[model samples]
Target: MLFRQLEYLVALARERHFARAAQACRVSQPALSEALRKLEDELGVLLVRRGRAYEGLTPEGERIVRWAQRILADRDALRDEVDALRTGLSGRLRIGSVPTASGAVPLLTGPFCTAHPLAAVELSTDLRADELLRQVRDFEINAGLSYLPEQGTEGVRTVPLYEERYVLLTGPADGLAGQPHATWTEASRLPLCLLHPGMQGRRVLDGVFAGLGLAPAPRVETDSVGSLFAHVRTGHWASVVPYAWLHVFGVPPGMRAVPLVEPVHSTPIGLVTAAREPGSVMARALREVARRTDLAGVLGALPKA
Candidate 1:
């Protein structure tokens, strides 16, 4: 019934281990266990499956966890709203983003900080879509920048930021560097260094190639954009990256960014936040920044879709 108990339950659901969950909540394992027991007794339903190791949650436990997420999100929003009204808009704004959109964070953070100078902003990057949603649901992050999933989750809000197009990054000496644009099939023939399949950006690229009936097999793959660019700078391996990232990476010396044409491909990226009543001050400020910023201009400057 207590907020702390719900916090413990949600932590346990996330960590999936009693000890680790307790550690995350800064409490003893036994104390957390006891709190869970009391919560189950109050609710008259089992909320967790117990075993020597951490077993998965029961059906009822899964349902309760959803409610727990909603309840905690609402509670945090209330506190934030009250604090913001008492003082100025002062609180932490946690944001998560994919590596490709990392450059766009400054667009939001810079303005929000300028507006609310005392507010603290924490930014974490390169999170998967599901992980980013989980953090928002758990109130770990106030908002996130990610590619909107095909199917949306309940109790979440999304604001489309921009459509990202892929561009070919190659050194000046590379064979294809002279071309203004390259087709997907043509790009596939090059010795390319690309992001691993786990990243959303890579998945988007894979879809584009699959649509063209060409399966792209990169000569080298990496998770970090920096590494991909580093190898491309050597004029050895070419890379496919988001167009917006071209300027951010500054097109390493002797490199050229060519737009991929023929069957142009792009993915929509957006800002996602929990749909809780009485929105937080930080969340409102961020939404304002998103509204005022020129996301379309930013995307327009990138390669044509």
Candidate 2:
């Protein structure tokens, strides 16, 4: 019945371990367990199916946990609202982003912090789309920067920030370097270095090649964009990456970025927040910053999709 009890229940649901949840809540395991037991007794419903180890939540428990998350989020928002009225907009804003969209975080965070000087911002990068959505739903992040999958998200609100265009990067000495555009079919014939398939960027690139009925057999695969650039610097390999990444991984000397056309591909990248009504002040502030920034303009300027 108590907010503290609901909090404990939610933490347990998220961590799936009583001891870890207790540690997260800064309470002893016994106290946490007692609180949950009291909550279940008061509600007259078994909120958790406990065993020697942390099993999964029951259907009723899952429902309760969802309610708990909303309650806790609203409570936190109320506190933030009251605090902002007294002290101006101020609280930590957490953001999750994929590697390709990492550059855009600063564009949003820099101006947001300037507008709300008391606010703090934390940015974590390289999360996949599903992970990003899960974090937003769990209130682990205030906003996320990720590709808007064509299928669309269920319980999230999104605003298209930019359309990311893929470009071919290679040393100037490479035969295809000076070319203003390269086709997927042409790029496929080269010794390429690429991001690992697990990344959303790689998946998009795979689709582009697949559309051409060509499967690019990369000479090397790496998880880091910096590594991809480094490999291309060796003058032996080429990489296909989003244009936004050019600034983050700084095109190595002697490298040229050629637009990929003749079936050019682009993916819409956007900012996402939970679909819940009455979002937190931090989330609202981020949305405001996103609105003011040149995200759409920057992306729109890229060569044809």
Candidate 3:
């Protein structure tokens, strides 16, 4: 019944172990167990599955965990709101982004930090579109920067940031360097270094190739953009990357970037946050940052894709 109990329960659900959960909550093991039991007694339903180890949450516990997440989120939102009124917005803002959008993140974060110097902004690029949404929904991240989902999703509001276009980055020594544009089919035939299949960007590229009836077998696959840059910078490898990336990370010394054409496709990328009304002050600030950002100016300066 207590907010502390909800906190403990949520922590337990996340950690999935009594001792670790207690450690996360900065409490002793017995205290965490007692709090959960008291919570169950107050609610008259078991909130955890008991065993020598953390078996899992009970069915009712599963549902309660969700509610606990919402309640804690709302509680934090309330606290942030009150503090913002008194201190002009001070709190940590967490944002998760897909790796391909790594370059574009600074566009939002820069202004956000400038506008609210007192606030702390943490940006992570190690998540996929679905994972980004999941973390946002779970309140693990305050917001997400990712490709817009095909179908509208529930419990989240999206603000379209910009359209992502494809391009091929290779060194001047590469054969295709002088080409005005390359098709997905042609790009697939090169000794290409590409993002892992798990990445949403890779999936989009794969879809383009599949539609052309071309299956690309990459020479090297990596999850790190830096790795792709490292290989391609040698002028021996070519890679397909977002056009914005060219602007973000300029065509490195010897590299040249060519737009991907002949069935060129563009996907919408955006900012996503929980749909909760009266959203956290930081969340609202990020929304404003998204709105005020000149995405066209940023992406437009880049070579067209």
Off by over 4 Å in 3: 303-305
lDDT per residue (tens digit) for residues 40-95 in model 1: 99999998889897797889999988788778877877877777788877778999
Q: Where does candidate 3 clash, by residue pair?
A: none
Q: Indicate whether candidate 1 or candidate 3 has the larger lDDT.
A: 3
Per-candidate Cα lDDT values, in order, are 0.83, 0.84, 0.88
Q: Which regions of candidate 1 fall more than 4 Å away from where they truly are? A: 302-305
Task: Encode model 3's per-residue lDDT on 186-208: one tens digit a residue.
Answer: 78889999999998989998998
**Using lDDT as the measure, which candidate wins?**
3
How are the candidates ranked when ordered by TM-score, highest leading?
3, 1, 2
| Candidate with the larger TM-score of 1 and 2 | 1
State, as a TM-score between 0 and 1, how close model 2 is to the true structure: 0.92
Estimate TM-scores for all models: 0.92, 0.92, 0.95
* Alpha-carbon lDDT of model 1: 0.83
How does candidate 3 fare on TM-score? 0.95
TM-score of 1: 0.92
